[model samples]
Target: MRDRIDEEITFRKLEVLLAFMETGNLSKAAEALNVSTVSVHRALHSLEQGVRCALFRHEGRNLKSTEAAQMLADVAQEVLALMSDGIRATRDAAGYSSDRLRIGSLYSLTINTVPGIVVDLKVRRPALQVELALGSNAELLDKLKQGTVDAALMAVPETEPEVDALPLFEDDIFFAAPANSPYAKLEAVDLRDCRDETFVSLGEGFVTYHGFVEAFRVADFTPNVTMKVGDIFSLMNLVSGGVGYTLLPGRVRGVFGDKVQFIPLRPQYLMRQTIGVSFLRARERDPNLLALMAVCRLRTRSVG
Candidate 1:
């Protein structure tokens, strides 16, 4: 029988091993993890000790995975994935079992769509509570995928195998610039009119970015991004600051003061993004989430 180490192992230790496998060298692994080589080395050693065998064979500062470790890598990934799934399910239950509903959204939705829906829902369910999580579309989608959120209002991706989305409303993108910015000078800006202009872009995980990218793609062009920020509000602020032009929604203008101006797009290269609620496939069976979805649909359509 194989012997287990006296001490217990942890998720962090397994994560370190995954990092090591991705990059065979400890230094590189630590670099990827933003940790010191010594810390990573210690973690690997701890994992090896717990498993009662050498996972990696090292010679002259070079590390090579043994056959056992290679086999275990697949198991490690599965275990980690399952652990994440379990944690999310538990957390979702905790979040939902209470009076509160954990909701997530893309930056654009946060500005008007989510607020409007939430306010309306609050009026109807005065006893209910809400917790908001904001981020890029990808971030929210990842959360919804894992059952970390009761629901999310955002744009559907080009494709998601696991997600079941109900379309709330489809809205077009706008060419919104600061009131006095150069892009606002156009009498009517064509899709290709701002070809060489610098755009203030949304950071990763945004459905706005996805829609913006698709607009450019349909125009057969790419944006010259001068800046990328984590939230759309920041992009609007930068636009009002006259940093650069940004592609945004008409509703986004409501959030800014007179300092910002947005123009209606020609929509020649248009892709209308849908704002809707998404939840885990399993949770669709839940009465609470489904009940929440109905409120979401009503609020999104009537949202001002």
Candidate 2:
């Protein structure tokens, strides 16, 4: 076998040689590879010296490839192609699904945020089939930990050692009531004064539920929750039909338009939900998750 230190022909040099062979000119090869002409010339000269052969000869002001160079280029092409296939296979064996990506999200996000991200991701990866699973924050996080989904779009959890989170935006919690309710006319609603009012809330395990409980806790009283629903749409329907008041994130303000009114909460009772995408720290380098993270970063910049 050849000595380790004697191996000088690298993949990068072969790539430059292939570019020069394809373009047939130093400046053109440099333009194709986005490198300077001097860099390309140096790489080709270094490659010729490493192989200890005359791979090119001067023809007027240009360099022409020899028959040996043509044979080496053919072998280089096959070697590079095989290396790429091996890499993809290795990633697949390591649990990186190249053809499909599973994503978890909240029911409330289906209105706008989820769709926007999905569309942008699709644009970036047209051949990728995306599967969306909708549930509460706890449900999605559980699915993420279980590996049932690649990543989750929800309220970022406070303490998850194995999960990596990228916050996209922050939404404030609002006091929701029926459009015709007396509370709708107020500039802001204080939880302390609404202690006697019956309320509907999302069930436990939802981020909104946690926010609701904490806000009331800060106000020094427990809310008179008469009913607990599993999803935000149902809770919105209850509030719209005059069932009872509920708390909601500002993102859902336009969902029920004229049917439900979302009012700002008093300063003391205020809460803000940090919405984001989360995935396993181990899978953070997975190509699909990387693309999702890139899209999330773009969304964060746009939202901000």
Candidate 3:
């Protein structure tokens, strides 16, 4: 029976003995017991056989531990301590976790619009945290659907049924030119105005660039794109340096200051876009998510 019970002894008993040795006695270990010292002794009895060795040599009421017990002392302590730490980590990640609203957006909003909302959100919820992830419009919408992000500020197709859209503000796309350049002199220029002009197109996947390109095709023109770039910053730099002209979001003017001018879009070829807050309605009841939406809705109103 003892040999069979020895097979049942586990790392659990070794951990208990290690704790007992750290206190230098049995009485102190009894205080920390989930069961009883009697149970600990019973477990230890079977444990010694499992290891096929004597952990302690009992002398009257005192038990002096052997070499194997001493060897496992530090390793068992580390393993047990880490177990406690793991439980604490799980508790923290579960409830009363960090109070943060993780907002994602297309590259177009990452700089100006989202920052403005973040400033207002901090004012209303000072202790509330804000995190931003910037990506393509399609990728951002995917993140919103994934529950990884709280909300997305993007110009998505109006018919996306899985998400609820809270319309924020609308801005038209227009032709851009370096400050003091000839294109800036034009008050209202249609896509045809630039049919003979060199166009600098942004890379695929960007909402602004894709929108501008699609709108140009609608107006029956394929731009004589002299240059193509991946990012708005790079495209803007090219435009500023007179590499080529671009049709872009009006908000881009805010980025370059007086470095560029955004002339009015014409032929009423308006790619007037409604930027909005997109989120899953199923999580609408979450308290922190509500606070975040409230701030976004309020900011949109203020802009309107």
Going through the candidates in order, what is the number of backbone clashes in each? 2, 0, 0
Top-scoring candidate (TM-score): 2
Clashing residue pairs in candidate 3 (N, C-alpha, C atoms within 3 angstroms): none
Ranking by TM-score: 2, 3, 1
Candidate 3 lDDT, 1-304, residue by residue in tens = 5545445456688677876887767766766766687877776677677777888888999877888878756666787788878866764453223478778887777777888888977888889888888776777888887767878888855677778867888878887888787767777876776778877877776778777777887879788888887777788888888888887787666688878778887766778777888877765655666776788778767766
Task: Give the winner by lDDT.
Answer: 2
Candidate 1, 9-51: lDDT as tens digits? 7878788888888888889999999999999989988877888
Global CA lDDT computed for model 3: 0.76
TM-score, predicted candidate 3 vs. hidden true structure = 0.64
lDDT of 1: 0.77
Which pairs, if any, clash in model 2? none
**Which regions of candidate 2 deviate over 4 angstroms?**
1-95
Residues 1-304, candidate 2: write the lDDT tens digits.
9655335699999999999999999999999999999999999998888888889999999999999899989999999999999988987765586788989999988899899999999999999999999999999999999988889999999889999899988999999999888887889998889889999999898999999999999889988889999999999999999899999999999788889999899998889999999999988888889999999899889877
By lDDT, the candidates rank as 2, 1, 3
**What is the overall TM-score of model 2 with all chains considered together?**
0.71
